[model samples]
Structure formats: structure tokens, C-alpha cells
Target chain A: MLSELDLSAIYLTLKLASLTTLTLLIISPPLAWWLARSKLFFRPFIESLVALPLVLPPTVLGFYLLLSFSPDSYFGAFWIQLTGSGLAFSFAGLLIASVIYSLPFVVQPLQSAFVNLDKNYLEVASTLGFSPIKTFYKVVFPMTLPSFIIAGALGFAHTIGEFGVVLMIGGNIPGETQVLSITLFDHVETLQYEQAHLLSISLLIFSMSLLILIYGVLQKRQKRLNDA
Target chain B: MPNNMLKFTLCKAGLFNFAAEINLAGVCGVFGDSGAGKTSLVRALIGLDEQFIGSVNFNNNVWQDDKHFVKTEHRQIGMVFQEPRLFPHLDALGNLTLAHNKRSLYTIETLAKLLDFENLLDKKTIALSGGQKQRIAIARAILTAPQLLIMDEPLSSLDAHSRALLLPFIKRLAKQIPILYITHSMQELFYLANNMLLINDGKIEAVGDPQKLFIDPRLSLVKHAHSGLLLNVTCLSWDETHAMLQGKVDGQAIYLAMDKPVEQEILQIKVESKDVIIATQQFPHSSLQNCFTSEVEQIEQISASHILLTLNLGKQKLLAKITAKSLQQLQLKVGQSVYSYIKAVSIIGEIT
Candidate 1:
């Protein structure tokens, strides 16, 4: 398997996961905040959509996103004209799929954290002459950082290990779309047990370490709050 | 723009329900039971309750009307909650400075030092004690230098020992700033409030000088804040010779000798109205040693059987709980002269 593969696949895998994790980080905060705080008329509908990926098969999300990004749809045509290409069969396409696949992993914890944040802090902050945005930034946001870290870590690791979603959309373009999970799949299909084992073990270690780090931080917070 | 006068009639809100007309520039305490609209009134006054329909007119500045509403940030008022909601990510100093708009008159260094938060400056909020966090919360509010500040049961979360320690700090802070302090504690009524706004069941039951209300018992709810009489005491030098607490009120010396001793401290003594009796003249040869010459100010009915009698005991006003029959037999009326007998055990609290 090592002899058959080039280094570009490895680089592409790391790049795709990092970029997807970053995009989710940028998008999830306000979405989670709104879901936690807002009472808009359409909030329930929007929340159900954000939660759809959690229960749907990975391939279903990939298929829908593929259609949304293909030239046949209105958005795909408009996006293609602007970006110069349809997103399918490309690294960007795989990144988009991974972000969707990891949506619940990031949003659920972040939303709960926002909801559980000490509300009195907001009241006190408001009375202290802080604007809402300032209170969120100075009070609510920092208190939710640990949750953000958990969301980001789970999202990054989940993306690194994703298979069905990326496979459906990106189609295993050798150097552009092939990620670590795809590489591992390819090795196992070809009966290269040793290379598959190495990749699988590495992914496992990464996920476990991320979870351990989250637990450590949460334990520290519990101790501090109890002592306080 | 004018300072606001907040009027509210609240009952449906889940947290608390009450009504009052709040006039700023002085301490207006909305004292009540824990769930009895104390926090709700504060929330409404500060624009935290969205469903509330109260009008707060600050001089010429009205925060809310029937249709137009001014947001909290635009209200320019500050509040201190029972539990200090200090930002966990920020240290004490950071919490204080975050609200400083630079155009404000107050200074952070002075507030930090005054709140005794200088030592806790770099400490995380989680690292603070209950007392310390409340101090930081108050200092943070003061740093904003708002036109007015509202406090909602701010000391209820604190233990009695902690409340005792912070009362002086709060007294000092409130004097320099106009604060609406809300608490059900009797001590707050006697020690903190200059004016009282009694709210019960979402209505303005009564509003007057706290001392006067206790004497009159205008509303049934006023009993909580007015549970005891307020007697002014000037320290008369600790009686080391007798090992007792000695103080003078209205030129009459009061000696309270327990194992614990403090004689020289300016404070107020609470005399529960129930532990008092009216005598035609000063009597002797009894367990009760506290006797004062007084005149009846008024006698009012508390219940079907009990009558609340108000007497001016020299410079201090005393309340006596007497039966309706006793009042009739003695012919006690307003301005009638008599001697009031107070059992020494009725002093439940000392407000210093």
C-alpha cells in the first residue's frame, strides 16, 4: 500500500480535515448561540435542519450536498460561475461534506454549553452598562470556551475518520480528494493489512486523546465551581 | 433627560410579582419575601423582563411607555444581583475595567482599593469566595458609573457571618451611589434603607420611613421589615467593671449583660412589640428591668384580638403588642401618657 500511494494523499487528508474543522468553528458559534438564546418564529425549523445530519446516514447528507454543489441546481450554477468550477470531485467538495458530517458533533455540545452558562452573569453584566454583544464577548463567550474546544476537537477527529460522506461526493480523486480514511479503505481492499492497521491506530489515538483533554478541562471546571 | 420614576404592577411573572413607584437619587428598597417580587421588580426596573408592562420614568427619561421601549443599554442604569455575576474568564480588575467607558467619573484603582479587590485583582472568579465575588460584582457596577443602581437580594446568598462583614462595605458603597437595595432581611431595613417601598402580592402595600412603618404596621406584610423597634444607642463606654454591654438611649442607660460583652458601639436595638406591656407608672420588683416613660402615639388593630400600640419612649419609638381588651381597659389613645415595659429578651437583633 505504501508503495502504491504518494504523499499527496496524506497531505490532502490533513488539509481537508483542518479546513473543515475551521469552517465549522466559524459557523457553529452564532448558530449555536441563536439556538440557545433566540425565540424567533422559525427557530424550531432551523434547529431541526441542523440536527438532521445527526440521524441521517452519512451518504444521504453527502448526496444532498453533492446535488446542491453540482451545476444542475441554482446555487451550484451560481457558485460555479463565481468559483470557476463545480465543487464535486475536488478537495473543496470533500471539505464541505466533512463539515456537514460533523455538524451535530460540534453544535450539540456548544449549544448545551451556551444554555448552561450562568445566566445571572448576563443580568449582572447588563446592569453594569455592558451592551449585549459586549456581555456575550466578555462574559458568555469565555465561559463557553471549554465547550467550543470540545466541539472543535470532536469535529476535527470526526472529519479525519469520515468515510461514506466524502466517498459519495469527492469520489476518491487520487491526490485531491483521497483522505486518510479513504487511504485506509483502499489499503484494506487491496489486502494491505499492515498499512491499514497503522492508519486505523493513529486515528483511534487522536480521537481518544482529544476526548481525554476535554475531560481534563471539565474536571478542573467542576472542582473550581464546587470550591467556589 | 430626567432621572426615572419606575412604576410597576407585577404578579404573573414567574420569578416575583409586586408594584411600586420608584424615585431615583435615594435608596428605595423593595423589601419583601424571597419570591414576593423583590427580584422581579428589580428585573423590570432594569429592563430584564420583556413581558412586563411597567413604565419607568427617569425625570424626563422614560425607559418604557405603552408602545415605545428603551433597551437596557440605553437605560443607563446599573444593577447588582444577589450573586455577583462576575465574568469567569476575567479577574477582579478585568471585571471592573470592562465596564469603564472612559467618560465616567469613577476610577477603577479607587474602586478596586475601596472594594478591597486589590489582592484579588489577578485572581480568577472561580478562585474567589462568596463574599469576594459579590464585592467584585458591586465594584464592577460602580465602575460603570451609571445614573442609578439596583440590587436584588444581593446579600441573600451570603451567610450571616458574611452578611455581617459586608454590611459596612455595602453601607459605604451605597452612600456614595444611589442604590435600590432589595432584601427581606430585617437588618437591611434598619441598617441600609433611608426610605422604604413595601411590595406584597404585586401591589404597593405601603411606602414610608421604615421605622415609622413598624410603629404603625400599615399593612400585614410590613411586619417582616418592621418586626422590631429601632432604638438609637450611643456607646456609653464598655462596663469593664460590671462586664456588660451598656449604652444610653434618650438619656436612659440600657444594660445588657451576657457572657458576650460590647458596651461602646453606636447601634440600634430591636424591641419586639409582643414582649412589651403598658403600666400607669414605672414598676419595680420584677424580672423586667427595662422600663421607659412614654406616650401613646396610636393604637391600631393587627388582627381581631391583637392591637399594635405605638409609644414614643423618649428619643426612641417603641411598639407594644397588647390585647384589644387591655387597650380598652387602660383607655390607651393617641397622646396618652404611660410607662412601657420591655422584656430584655425581645431584642432580637442589633443594627450597627
Candidate 2:
């Protein structure tokens, strides 16, 4: 049987992942659309900046985030003034770190989908007397629904398994910032081999199951579209 | 008259620089060769290409000018593209519903029945054939209740049977609203266009009646093998004994071989220049059943071996292709009366 600490870690991980995924869904669409369609000279520069977390080490990102979230930094000072609390080692700060870490996972799929969309659909919708916003909702959104699902699942799953950024900024605070990965790490470090084995196996099964479920749903949807 | 006219003076700089200024009314057929900038002109007129300079004024409403531009949705113009661009995610009915505005000209049921596609509404768009998809696309455009309908080679991708089936529908729609139809086929031009615009190398070559423009020696259409004229004929009665359709052109009786009875009062028959046989005098004893006494209005040498003759059949004109040797042998001259014999089997009546 798992201890109360392990169960709490699982609950906190789910909560953090859900919130991050929701925030990303709200913000990433416009950003991805712009990246896909804009012709500005500095577009490539912005694209590279968005993709930085994909190649850079997570601890390197965590180190910078830790510095920025400290009480002395300008961002941390502003956040403290607004919320009446320090940002370092806090749930709010941990969420910010996880979002940055999982951004590329959510945004790349959406950008490619937007890029490859058939332009005739937009033109036809316009000729049919639909406004630009209405066209996006009616034509673009439905055509790219599969990409959205993939992006959400990837963002959620990636956030759930995060360890380096959470540890550097969240500081393993039980029932607060401490998540499944960090809990497993703590168990192994304390030489509690039995608990560590149980935690590792459970996480392995859970991640595999999530991925399989998402891919299965996507395949079924593709078949339905083709058959219908 | 200006209030109901479509006038535009547009210019664009690209691989092929395009420039045109014209005031058009009725169903204007835009004819050109491939790469003549027909699609580009349509894009500019419909506000799809923002780089075009100059202006477009449709029915006294300024669609585009130096400072202001109306978006495509607000221009109140319905367009049918070369290909059927239906939404695959929506069924046929759903696609139509998206374009059903408060001012729709016809209800969905009426439109489906009129277009003969009532069976297609519940089917997914991906499963529909090319012709079926195009029907739904046409229905969607009309459902918007636009002021002007623009069809850009809507039948170019369709098969002959589909083309035949859809022509009458388009003709019926033209009676309600002015249409700007783009096409490369002269048959479609003769069947649909009351006014014609000829484009070559991205410039307006001429604009006038299609029947007259088709025979103009300076235009490119005259150089084609199938260049011909359209004659307006009224069905008089069916000759049941001879199994032929009796019709009249310019008060002269004409006969046509048809497998079906005449369903319409007025019909247009295509007469290829090559199919016309010129005789110096009428021969009373011959197998040719239809003959007309026409006066030679003009004669122009088209090639080293061939000459094209324009004959006056009262108010209508007929073109005859003849060899230069025959012209010299017969000593044919302008203002001379000649007998023009057209075979009954060669004339096919086009239902209007």
C-alpha cells in the first residue's frame, strides 16, 4: 500500500498538469497562428526563442527561473507587490516554470497544422459571407481538431513527468509544490528501495497508458474522418 | 445605367503585367487563353489580391479604391471557383446552412430541388462526386443572396454530361442576377454570354457581342479550327413525317435532326464555319434540306489557302470557310448573293 505522501504527490501532479495545460490552450493558439502565417523579418528570431526550451537543458532553464523568482529580482518584486507574497519555492512559481518547460510540446504541433491547412477553405468561407473570426471557428478549428488534441495531451503528459525545473524552483515542499517525480526521487535518495520500486513502476505504467490512450483516440478519429 | 454597371480599371505588376478598364452589364463572358490572367483579374475584382492598383465599382458601390477596400464577405458577390471547395468536415446540408443568411434568395429545400441535388444534403462532402460537390458549392453561393454572381470556369473541371446538366441551371440563375462568367470554351460562351470580353497576353483585346467578336479576324478565336457563329432560331413545329425539327431563322425555314422534342420556345444552334457550303446558285434537286440565300458582306483571306466570308442573313451574320482556289474559281465578290447550304445532321440545337 502507498503512503499518504505518495497519494498527495499524485494529486498535486495532476492538479499542476491540468492547470498548465489549460493556460497553454488559452494562450498558445494565437501565438502559434502568428508564427505560422506572419512574414515579418524577425519572425525567425521569435520562433527560435520559443523553441529554446526544447534544446536547452532543463536545469539551465530552472537555474534562470530560480534567479528570476527570488525576492530581490524585478519580476519577483512585482509579483510580490501584486500578490502580497514572495514567488520563490511557491506553487504559483512552480506552475510558471512548468509552462515554459512544456511550451514547445504544445505549440509546434499547432503551428505545423496551421501551416499545412488548405487555404481554399478560408477563401470559400469568406465568399460564403462568413467573417474572419467565424471562418476560423467553423472551418479552421474543426479541420485542425486532431492537432489540438495531440498538443493538449503532450503538454499535459510532459508537465506531469517534470523533475529538474520543479526541484530547482519548487524545493520539494510536501503537499504544495512537491510532485510525483520529486517524491520518487526523495524515496530513492533515502534508501527506501521498496517504496522507490513501487513508485517507479506505477509512474511507468501510468505514462505508457496515457500515451496509448491518446494515440488510440487519434487513430479512431482519423479512421472515422476517412470512412465518413 | 451607370448605377447597374460593373466598372473597373485595374493594373498589377507581376510575371505578367495586367491592365484593363471596362464597363460591363448583363452576363459578361470573359474569354482568354491559358495564362492570360483570367484568374488574376477575378482575384483582384473580388478583393483577394490586395496588391492590385486602381479601383472596382460594382452597382454604384465602391468595392476597392485608392484608400478604402471592402472585405470579400461584405462585397455582396457570390463566387464559384474552378474547383469545388467544399468543407470536408461538414455534410452537404451543414455546408449550405453556414451560408444561409437572413436574406437568402431561396430556401434550402427549394435550392436543392432546383439544383437537382436533394439526395446529396445528408451525405458527407468527402463522399460526394466532383459534380455533386460542385452542385453543393453553387447552392452555397446562391444561398448568400449576393447581388452579383461570379463563376470562374465553374464547368471546366466537369465532364460533358455534368456540363450539359448544369448549363440550364446556370442559365436560369442568370435571369435573376447578372453574372460574370469566365471560360475558355467557345461553346459555353455562345450558350451563356450576352456580352463578351476578349483577353490576350493579360490585356483586353475587345469587348462586344460574342457572336460578332467570334468572327472578328483580328481576334485569336477566328484562328481556331472550331470558330463559328450562334444563330437564334425559333421552333416552328415538329415535322413528324420526316422526323426532323422545323425551325425559323430570319424568316427562313430551317430543319434540324433531333432525337428529343423541343422543350423550349427559342434555341441556339452552333454552325461551324467549316460546315457551311457555299453555292453560286440554289440547286433545286439535291439532298441538302436547308438552304438560305445570303449576300456576301465581307471577305478576308485568313491563310494562304483559305478565305473567311461573312454573309448577311437579314439581321444575323454567318461565317463560311472556303479555299482560296474555290473563291477564285467561283469569282465570288462582295455584295453578291450566294446560296449557303448547311446539313441538317450537323446542326445541334442548344436549349436556352
* Top candidate when judged by TM-score against the true structure: 2
Model 1 achieves a DockQ score of 0.50
Model 2: per-residue lDDT, tens digit, B216-292?
77887776433567787888888777778888888888988877677766677877788789999888898888898
CA RMSD of all predictions: 4.3, 2.8
- Quote fnat for model 2: 0.75
For all predicted structures, in order, the TM-scores are 0.82, 0.92
TM-score, predicted candidate 1 vs. hidden true structure: 0.82
Which of the numbered candidates is closest to the native, going by highest DockQ?
Answer: 2
DockQ result, candidate 2: 0.73
For model 1, how does the per-residue alpha-carbon lDDT over A1-228 read when each residue is reduced to its tens digit?
A: 354363566677778778888999989988898999998999899988888888898888888988898899997898789999888887777777788788888988999998998777777676776777787777777778778888998888788778888888888878888877888888899998998887777668867887898889888986876675
